[model samples]
Target: MIDVYLFSGFLGSGKTTLLKHMIGQVKAQGLKPAVFMNELGQTNFDSDSVDDGVPLKELLDGCICCSGSEKSEAQIQTLLAEETFDVLMIETTGAAHPVEALDAIFSPLFAERLNFKGIITVADSKRWLSRDELSPQIRSLFLEQIRHADLILANKMDLLTEGEQAKTIFELQSLNPAAQIIQTVHSKVPFKQLEKTTAKKSDDVVKAPVAKLNLDTRVLRFEAGVKRERFEEWLRTLPDTVYRIKGYVPLEGDKYPHAFQYAYGMAQWLPEYMKMQPQIVVIGEGLEGVELP
Candidate 1:
């Protein structure tokens, strides 16, 4: 049976970055890995970020919540059947519910071949502290992610001071004392400690009610660089209904275009300086009619 670790967190909580770190550790430990990404809507960061050697499978139709368990599990089934590996890492969207996704893996087809090591929920320290300002919908998801995890990895600890980091760990431990709270920046940590969860926590997680967040999800697939300034303006001119965005953009004539990623009201600029055409992705709420140059 292949050991499986479910990496769960809300958008911008650094789920993708953590995957990179975990895979590197797996390689160092001489373990081969197969990764499955449910990169729904407009995100384009998964494929390019991984090395050429590790096999990858993607399910990009929509959020896992919308896809349901059976279909999502089928994608995992397909990937496992196609390639054999020593371990599997599932990086779920920050918006997705981890328990629901984990439960899907319970299907008989996958259960026999897989052993769930533990669920690792990577928490966003600074942002989570300021979650009250966020929409109730986003806040609820983050809390549920923490509530359901068997192990909680508080990433981006570098963003905080020594005192703040201590407080954050204390607060996190108070949130779920049963969970092993490991802190690090960019999800860098020794895997031997992170992957083990022999604690006897109860099976039930107290779920906070989720509000009807007007999720403005879209698929932005564009190949253009209509002046970075113009595109930035286009991004700002979008409707208030737009909540989040993620995708890749091949800058005109530039090796790899720019990648647009937004989470919890924060945006990041990921420029690809390599000599590859930017075939990227973009997903947001109010970007229905917006087009890239």
Candidate 2:
């Protein structure tokens, strides 16, 4: 049976980073790996991070737990039929509820053909600390993600103080006493650690409701290079409802576009060596009227 790993996390929680690392490690072990990525936006930006020659499937513009659940099963079926990989990794949309995602993937059509490893959740240290600021629904979803994880990756530890790290681990442990928690920076964890994780068998636990969160996404395409200072100024004007922003932006005086990411009021820019489309995907609540640079 093929091994399958499910990745669950909130927006900007570093699931993709960990996914990339696992792909590399699986390849190094002389085994082939495949990926099925779910995105909340119409355009897929994170898909580009997967390495060349790896089998990949994308489910876009919806979460796997609700409207896209049937589509995801079809995509997985197609991947299995065409790919010669030994391991398959499914990365759910950041906003996906863990129980619903598992329900969608545990379809009887293909359940017996695979070994369900576990759900590896990447919990942003800073986000966990300030989860109270989020809406009641979002906070509940976030907690549920942790509550169902088989292995909880306490990511972004570098951004936290020592005390904050302890608090984050303690809170996560309190939420899911059965799962193992690992502190990590950039979502880095040994592949062997992940290989040993097995899903907790629980037929009695209640599953989360089958509904998507009320999140909005807006795509901003830039026709001209934007000044870095002007873009930073625009970011400062954003309201707290804006949860995550990621994509490429062509900056004035730069030969190539820079990859930009913003989460929980923090912004980061990384220069890219190759040219990419200058577009940004903004995910948040009530983003239809938000202005952009």
Candidate 3:
């Protein structure tokens, strides 16, 4: 089984920035973990922030509410089947309902391989008060995000004054009586703090039973040695339908294992999990065959 951590926060609430900071400890600990991100556009910084040592995976371009959640779950399963990872951290889009992630993780296909660690939310100390006062939708979402969190990161503490900080902390405590409210600036915390399991005393554990999302799907998994020249040709010939590709292969005489991936349209390569299995996943429009190696 793998440890799964779900992180939720409002847009611009510093989830990405804080996640980046936490990943620094992940690198320092020498604990290589795989990160999955589901977002609106194609841009993500989770993978780029690390020291090119920690392997990161992304599922972007579509929100989890769309076909991306299924695709993301499938990719995670295939990865676990190939190489065992120490942990998996997932960051949902700001607009995504936390229950949707809970449903996806607890589903039949994924439940067997992973277990829930905890849910975390990053709240902006300065803007949250006004957000709650002005926009009811934002307030509801914020409360929902915090209510489910095992940890509430009072991020952006640098922006709040001394008095505002105390009031913000008190308000968060009132809103989420169960979560451990911690003051943090820029997601600064030790790896143990984020990974440690917390006790649950409250009954409201975010069980938003949701209908299973049905998906018409397909898969292809295979291994074929490419002549050095054929390697570049194969890479260039990749169809646009290929949503993601990940695995370890010798790009040049086995000097270094080349682990790479393509999400949406952007792709990157990093040497990792050299001794593990060779695997990759491509998801997109009109998929049908399940080719196996």
Candidate 4:
């Protein structure tokens, strides 16, 4: 049986950063690790950040928590047969709920061959402390992500003051007294602590929170290469309602396609070699019919 680790957190909570560190640690320990990533939008950007050594299976277009809308049984089966990794790490969309993600991951067909390792959640210290600043849906989603976690990495500690840090701990512990809470900077938590074998097996003890996201997605495809300046400008000027923008773009001056990732007003561009069409997927609230230049 392969050990499966589930990573869940709110949007832009630093799941990718933590996963990259954990992947390296797992390799140093002489264990082969594979990653299964689920992105909320159709276009992907974080996949480029994953190391080339690790085998990755990406589930796109929807959250895995929703049963019919986002199924992973076929993908899981494919991974189990084709990949040789002893450990499989699943990184769900930052907005995913633990309960639903867990259900989708341990589909009835593959449960016997898979061991339920545990759920690791990364919480942004600044975001958690400023709940009043978020929308009702986001605030509820963030709280639910932590409630069922086996380990909670309260990340971005560097941005918090001593007093704010203390309160962040108090708030997380209040919601998930059972989870091991660790303070981390840039989502860095020791991998040894993450390798803990304790797994939660009850789906009945506590009720999982239900969240309905009223978000929309748009995919912009470009047949020709785009100017880096214009692409960066669009990313920097995205409306506040936009949550994430990702995909690959063939830059006018670059030898390879450039992967674009934008969230929380931050834009990141990296060279991508993957043989995929140049397209961008924008996900956000009130984004229907929003034109992109």
Candidate 5:
């Protein structure tokens, strides 16, 4: 049976960083790894991160837990039929509930071929500390992500002070004491150690009480190149409800479009060598009819 691992976390919690590390480690060990990624927007910006040779399947425009579950099963079925790999790594959307994602994977058709490894959750230490600032629904989702993991990585430890770090670990431990919690800067952890961990088995998997979040996404296409300064100014005008933004932007005078990411009021721009589609996907609450500059 092939090993299957689920990577769960909130928006901007470093799941992709951990995924890259795992892919490298798996390759180094002479093992093949396949990736299944789910995105909230029609365009998947993170799909570029996966290597060209790796087998990749993406479910876009929905979360696997709800509207995307059927699509997810079909994608997995296609992957199994088309690819030969030792392990399959599934990276769910940030808003996904871990239990629901697992349920989607436990399909009868492919159940015998997969050895369910476990859920590895990446929690932003700073986000947990300030979770109260979020809406009750979002906060509950964040906690549920932590509560269901077999192994939890308290990521972004560098951003927390000594006391805050203590509290972050303490609070996470209080929520799920059975899981091993590790402090990581960029979701870094020992791959060999993770391989030895198995998920806790229970006869009954309680469904999470929280309903699906009323989150929505907006895709912004740039018809003309814009000044970098002006783009940053527009980012500042975004309200706090905008949880995550990622895509490529064509900045004036640059040879290639730059990859842009925004989360928790911070924006990052990375220069790209190849020109990509000049569009940005904004994910947040009540984003319908929202205007972008």
Candidate 6:
């Protein structure tokens, strides 16, 4: 039986970071793993950053919990039929609802062959307390992502004060009393805590919540290599309305393409060898007429 793990969290909550770490751990154990990354727009960065030789599939243009469900189910069936992997890791888009994701995975087609392992949610401590500033719908999305998690990682603890950390934990507990919470910096959670024997079904999660976020995505493509320093400077000064910025950027004088991720005013880059056109996908609410340098 294939053990399956679902990694769910709000955008910029470090789901991709934790998923990469978990994939590395699984590889270290000599176990084969397959990844299904659910991305909101056509552009994908996390899939490219995955270094494992394991088969990776991207469910793009929608979240797996909603519009992408059919495609996601199909991908799972295809993997089960054509590939061999000891485990499967699914990284859902930040806006994805756990209930809908569970419903899609636990469908009759996947019932017998797959063993649901764990639902891990990563929470940004700073973002946690700033929910009130976001639109009501987005705030609900954040809370819903935490509601059904088996393990909730209170990440980015370094940015919080002692009093803020206490309140963050208290709020998280109030939202998800059943989840096991672990505080960490940079979403670094113990690998052993991720493996599990039991799983929860659609009924186990709350009823499927409708997504009301008016998210807009802008895709920018650059055919030529861009100067790393100039790009970095522009990324550092992105508008506050931009919640997520991800893409494959070809840097000048570099043989390999660079993968970039920008969230909450922080930018990260790593050498990525994925053979894809260079483009960036910026996602956020109220992004109309937004220009990027």
| RMSD to the hidden true structure, all candidates | 3.2, 1.4, 11.8, 3.0, 1.3, 2.5
Model 2 Cα RMSD, Å? 1.4
**Candidate 4: misplaced stretches above 4 Å?**
68-70, 203-205, 221-237, 248-258, 269-279
lDDT of 5: 0.89
How far residue 66's Cα lies from its native spot in candidate 6, in Å, is 1.5
lDDT of 2 by residue, 178-291 (tens): 999999999989999989998988674566653446889999998989899999999989988899999999999899999998987888898899989989999988896786
TM-score of each: 0.83, 0.96, 0.65, 0.84, 0.96, 0.89
Return the lDDT, model 5, position 35: 97
- lDDT, model 4: 0.79
Local accuracy by lDDT, each model: 0.71, 0.89, 0.63, 0.79, 0.89, 0.82
Candidate 6 on 14-117: residue-level lDDT in tens? 98889878888888999988888888887676776588577888888887977788888988888778888898989999888876787667879877888888
lDDT of 3 by residue, 1-293 (tens): 77788889765566766677766666577766767776654544344454565556667666664467787777666666666667777888765667656656666876877867888888867666566352444456666777778888998788778998999999889988878888988677666877775634335564543333221223233354435466545656655444344444455445445665543334456765435444444443334543432
Model 1 earns a TM-score of 0.83
Q: Higher lDDT: candidate 4 or 5?
A: 5
Tens-digit lDDT string for candidate 4 (115-160): 8778899987887877776778877887888888899999988988
Worst 10 residues of 3 by lDDT: 212-221
Comparing 1 and 6 by lDDT, which wins? Answer: 6
Tell me which of candidates 3 and 5 scores higher on lDDT: 5
Candidate 5 lDDT, tens digit per residue, 1-293? 99999999998898887998999899999999999999988899988889879999999988899889988999999999999999899999999999989866799989899999899999989888889999889999999999999999999999889999999999999999889999999888888867976888855445579965878889999998999898888888877788899999999998888999888877888899997999999998987666667
